[model samples]
Target: MDLLVVGGGPVGLVVALRAADAGLTVTVLEPRHGPVDKACGEGLMPAARERLAQVGAAPNGHDLASIVYTDGRHRVSAPLTRPGLGVRRTVLHAALLEAADRAGVQVRHTRMIGIEPGDPRDHARPARVRTSDGQERTAPFVVAADGLHSPTRRALGLERPARLPRRFGLRAHYAVAPWSDAVEVHWSRNAEAYVTPVADDLVGVALLCRPPGRWDPTWRSFPELAWRLAGSEQTSAVRGAGPLRQRVRSMVRGRVLLVGDAAGYVDALTGEGLTLGTAQAFAAVDAVLAGSPAQYARRAPALGRRSTLLTRGLLAVSGQPAIRRLIVPAAARVPAVYRGAVHQLAGGH
Candidate 1:
């Protein structure tokens, strides 16, 4: 194959689809079948929505028109310049999988143990990967989209365990009519409740907190979020992910390119993972098509600069109780600042 993409998540499939559309042979390796689920906020920024359309993975989902920052008493909201999608992760994955198939990208069931850089003499040969069943495969190019806890990235010796105060996210679905078109972020002293309208009749609630058992209790820390979700029957089991941060040394080494969370990640405070991953996948594929894998290393991080800064800033504010108390109030005092940030985040530039 010209391109061998590891981890058939949305971003991985997107890489394969784009490469195949560009007339490159592509194959995706994933252990799971269709509609794989994960703990995600499930809100796509407008940029990610556009990329999904470009890749022909047009999945229908609830429309997100704005973002609301609130602390129950204080609230600030800004309309999106471009609309976004509040989609279930499984639903989005299924759509991307179908699109990958239509693009003639082969999907294989296997687990990648690790990646070994290809020989220096054969620049066209891809790094080798050992599978769970003791099978090895090599290709001209490889994009790792295996996610935050990626084994491929570990094997590449590009990761360092997070040393900062870490947090995790747990998500569950509630069967209820969406309260609003805006994604509501309910802030509290301990954790923040991310409420997203994933369907006409379903709202996905994801909690970002330091503690482990907080998710099972259902918004107990944030009374405002709890009240809104009160009496809404839970529709899905709780799923979780990460310390919410992964550090990487680089995006490219030899013929391998790290895309999506597999590349590196910051806190998910801004919900920009999907957007950044989609952009990186496209960038990686473009470099592969140009026969210059090193180009992706320079381009991928630039794409995430805005997102990283915003997320780190927000995480810092949220970590400080005094500053957290002022966030929504300050935003409300100056609506344009909030609006401008929202517009920029919605891909208005």
Candidate 2:
């Protein structure tokens, strides 16, 4: 095959579809079947929606007009100049899978357990991958989109140690109508609860926080949100993912490249994870088609530079109680700056 994309998630499928469109044969390896779901904020920025549409993977979702941050006492909202989307992870995955099928991209129900880099002396040599079935496959270029805790990245020894306090994400869906058209982020002393409307009668709530010794029940942290959801039926079991920060040594090594969360991840504080990952997928395909895999390493980081900077800045403040408490108030006090920040978060100039 021309390309082997590890992980059949949205970003991986995106790589497959794009490569196939360019007349390159592509295959995707994912142990899980279609409609794979994950614990995510479920809010796609306006730019992300457009990118998915361009690739023919747009899915049905609730429209989001703005972002509102509240600490109960203080609240501020920034309108997205363009509308965003609140899509369930499963729904988004299904859309991407359908597009991949239409593009004639092969989907294999196998896991990639290991990778053997192609000859360093010959850039044209195909890289070999060992699947969980104990079979080996070769492809001219390999993309490791195997998520945050990527086995491919670990096997390659590219994992970097994280120095900050570990934080986790927990998500669940509630069977209740959305009260607002905006994505609401409710802040507490210990954690932040993200409420996004994914359907006419379903909203997803995701929590970003440190391990729960500082707060118990977790729901207690967001009193207002808990009250609002008190009588609502839970639509899905809670899903969690953590130590949110992932650092990587490099994105390129010979004919192999890492995209999406496998490349690196900061915090999802700003809800731009999908947008950033999509940008990496675009850069990866361009580099591969250009016959310059090394260019991806140079281009990937710049693609998410703006989002990373803002997310890191917010994460730092989130760790400091006094500063964190000032966030909503500050944003409220300076509407222009807050709006500019929101515009930048949406991939605007």
Candidate 3:
């Protein structure tokens, strides 16, 4: 394989498909056989939609719309203006995997055990990978899109930063018409629930907060905003997602690169995780095909900074009851500010 990618998640699949399209022989190694169960809000920003279209991997039957934000007391709505899609993670992954297969990229249902740095002079000798099933795969470059707690990243001696203050997330889907064409992000102190309309009849809801030591206590602490929606209808059971925390630093190391949550992830507040992953996938693939690690290295900081800013901003707002009280009212009364903020939340910024 010209490149060995560890993790068959969305970022990994996108990397494989893009590289293959660029005429590179790519192999994706994933521990899971089929679609990995993803706990995400499952909304794609305009930029993400554009990237998918560029790669010819856009969803066929997905719903497209903007997002709406409310606080139960006050509400603001904005038309997407640009293209955005609300497709389930599984559906999105299936499309990417199909595209990878069509592009002649090999998919291996095996786990990567370790990665050792190789000699820079010899492309083949620079990176060596070991698989859990005793299979060894070697390539000029290795990609660690394995995710937030990446084993490949650990094996490469990459440093993991201290976990962020708040560390947990809960997400699920419901079968109901969205209150508006735009995604609805309702805010409350200590938490925020994002409701993204994936289809006319289905909405994706996710909550993020501090994790409790025990399972029962964790679910108990999660704030329930979906149930408070003005005219919400019952459709699906509530699902839980994560103890996801923000990662510090860049996502690149020598010939090994990280994309999506593997590199660094922000809270679900901004709804930019999927967009960031898709963008990084393109940048990484382009860098690999062009034989320039520098290109890939340059792309992470700006995106990472933005993610951090958004996450912190949301945390700040959600943490202070007074701030939420003041801001929510101001946002509702100020249409321009409200629209811009909602646009940013939709990952337009």
lDDT of 1 by residue, 1-349 (tens): 7888999999999898888888999888998877899998999989999999988998989999999999888899998878899999989999998898788889989899878867434775668887886889888778899998988888888897775788899899999999899999888887778899999999999988885546655566788887887899999998989888889988887888999999999977778888889999999999989877778878888998887888889888878888888888898999998888777666776
Q: Estimate each model's TM-score.
A: 0.96, 0.96, 0.88
TM-score of 3: 0.88
Using lDDT as the measure, name the better of candidate 1 and candidate 3.
Answer: 1
TM-score of model 2 vs. true structure: 0.96
Q: Which candidate should be chosen as best, given lDDT against the real structure?
A: 2
Off by over 4 Å in 1: 119-125, 216-218
* Residue pairs clashing, model 2: none
- RMSDs, each prediction? 1.5, 1.6, 3.3
In order, the Cα lDDT scores of the candidates are 0.87, 0.88, 0.72
**What is the alpha-carbon lDDT for the whole of candidate 2?**
0.88
As a whole number from 0 to 100, the lDDT of residue 233 in candidate 2 is 89
